[model samples]
Target chain A: MKTCYNCNRLNKDNDRYCRYCGKAIRNNSYYTGLKIGIVLGTLGIIIMLILYAIMYL
Target chain B: MKCIKCGAELEDVDNFCPECGELTAKGHRFFHDPSNLDILNNGKAVKLKKKFNAIISIFSLSVIIFALLMIFTGQNLMTPFGVIQKKINYYRYGYNTSLIKTNNKYNFKVNNYDEAIEFIKKDFSNQLYTCNQNKELTMLEYELESDYEIPSVVFCDMSLEEAHKIKDVIVRMYALFPNIKGNLTNITITNSKTGSDYVAYFQPAYQFVNVNKDIKENNKVNKTQILLNSYYFLNDNILSQDINEVLNNYYVEDATFESTIAHELGHYISFVAFLREKGVSNITLVTKDNEEEIKSLINEFENGEYLKNILEQALNNYNLKYNENLNLQSFAETISKYAGVKDKNGNLLYSETIAEAIHDYYLHNENAKKSSYEIVMVLKSKLKEVF
Candidate 1:
């Protein structure tokens, strides 16, 4: 079960929205997106440095 | 959680206000922790971060490509962005270019050697004229050539007027020893304020002159080009007085600027003769290992006892009435020191003895001692035979 802070209503635990009001549920997408971004950025920089050494040095 | 609209305490399972019927669960979450804001603005934040990452990725890629291009092309990556090509010109031509800074101020270059000569002529026209018109008295012929590896003259701490005076001195030197003009290349003029320790010197050109003809005709590789200094011209009056006082000769047709220039030219002439006698073209090739053999041979002709004795006699006369203030002893020593002895500055003293003897032989003529006169005559005849 979950409680809606806006209206003090009790709702089912699996419900994404309160039974009395409508609001999107918070999820872990933000953390997932940030982790993927950091990994990809690091990989890109490493690849650039390797290519730079081979071609220039 | 508590309801915001009706100040009512609520259990976690509540979805609406029990007293007021206000909905609670459907409202936006009260951001108790700052990290919750990221969840709320997840879509926009992700898009912004991705945009920033793309920008950085693109910039890094561009840098890598630029570095690779520079390495492949053998271009200098550190050269300023616009003048990279000019830097290449300096390596290619081995002559003055706009990229080279003279006196750390002026940047000068020409399309070719001829243009370089013309540039100098145009800048110092009045001085060149003074030298040319007075060639008979100065005994110098102006031969400004741009084909050489360096500028004929580099001036430091000198005005255009003084540069003109130095030009006159060089013109006189060339006129006195016309044969040496071919082997001579450049002259650098610097004043006392600039702190020129060498006072005057001659730097041989490293590259072979007339490379194709030299290899075919002489079977030799490089030839030396003589360079002269202009420090002596900085204080002509004081130097002339000192020379007159040291030599006990009146300021007549003897030791003047002409004598100094002639003395330097004598050094060039002796080197040329030495090269010709050895059947060699490059002096740099004659390293210290073979220098003694070559010097011994050259000295047999240039460093005879007769010339040395006369030089010593002159120095002895000067030292008898030495002036503590004047560098007359050093000046005289430059012209007449014994072979192998170093000066106060640890430089070889008698390197110019033969040159000095030659100058005196020319100045004093029949009045010069028998041995000195004969030696100068032999050098003159040998120069004529070889060159």
Candidate 2:
């Protein structure tokens, strides 16, 4: 699904225009990528802390 | 909701403002909120969300599992710094409070590695009774200590120096063969008396080999060897015997108590390697499902022609060099009495033969090495191949 920035309504993935707002619906994969980055970045920090404990503590 | 372009009230289902014909929000919540997104395009967006979640979940779970493996196995999982860390741990084994107390009591006057070894040698040399001469001696079982829940030896009746000598042996053994560290557990140092004729023996816990708790829990699918809960009984009277006496008795020259420990460890190492060669990935896993098959394979390897061929060829080499008339029986006897030992069917237990070769190599026994160089080289190459 794509969300129209102008009217903030969800649209069908194949539809270039929002069904409700009739505005252009841009692909929101960028938001998904940002979520993934946050998740992995948090995991990286946890692993680093574990490695630190094993080596030094 | 009100349209941004004009002040006109719109119903939730309305797509456009009635007054100005501007587009309405259509009751949509915040754009940043994922829960606010409606199921559109046949739930393709929800499917993508599930895929993203699955990927993240699997990755996070793998990292957690890897970390647990590293901790339980005391392995760094071959990270770049693992070797350095292992080297550090290798030196750290014998530096505990007990070792410090022993050094303080003995006033070892040690300056370096060689000097420390000299002190250890002096502590074990020319003691009370020779192993052969130990007749009608009392057998006193010492309480076992626990390290990582593994049963370690506690020196009850031993002088601090004697206890320290075996400690040195354990530390040196770990330094030499780090892989054999946790595998060698349940070390019981029988006090001062040679109650048993054997210097030391490794009682293989065949049962523990198949108990796959760790493998099952960790889900380790890799082919790895694990000798769990094996017993290594050490008779301290062996230390009292001179190196020459040990050679005369065992026929493997310079075979110190350390060599015997190495020999026992060699049994564990060789058994694991044999299982690996026989297509047994993990002993615990194999034994869990195919108990009979694993037993059959173990029996086959124990009495297999692979070791017999090595022995026969090594004996041939020895006989050719020294012009000695010795068959496999006599040749094995010459290697060590333990090597000549037979199983229930009277077939040669080649495990002992390989262990004797490892023992000789460990102590740098020149005579044994020269006589049985083939078997020794085989053992060395096998250890290299697996480890």
Steric overlap count per candidate:
25, 0
Q: Write the per-residue lDDT of candidate 1 for residues B182-275, one digit (tens) a residue.
A: 4444454423333223334443333232223322232211223333233344434333455555444422235664355455656666666655
TM agreement with the true structure for every prediction? 0.35, 0.40
lDDT of 2 by residue, B186-266 (tens): 454332122234555564433322134443232111111211111122223445666547456653666665457667766
User: What's the residue-level lDDT of A23 in candidate 2?
Assistant: 45
Q: Which segments of candidate 1 are over 4 A away from where they belong?
A: A1-57, B1-142, B146-151, B155-176, B190-199, B203-254, B284-350, B362-372
Please list the Cα RMSD from the true structure of every candidate, rounded to 1 decimal place: 17.7, 20.8
Model 2: number of clashes?
Answer: 0
Every prediction's TM-score for the first chain? 0.51, 0.56
Give the CAPRI rating of model 2: incorrect
- iRMS, model 1 (angstroms): 11.3
lDDT for B28 in candidate 2 is: 41
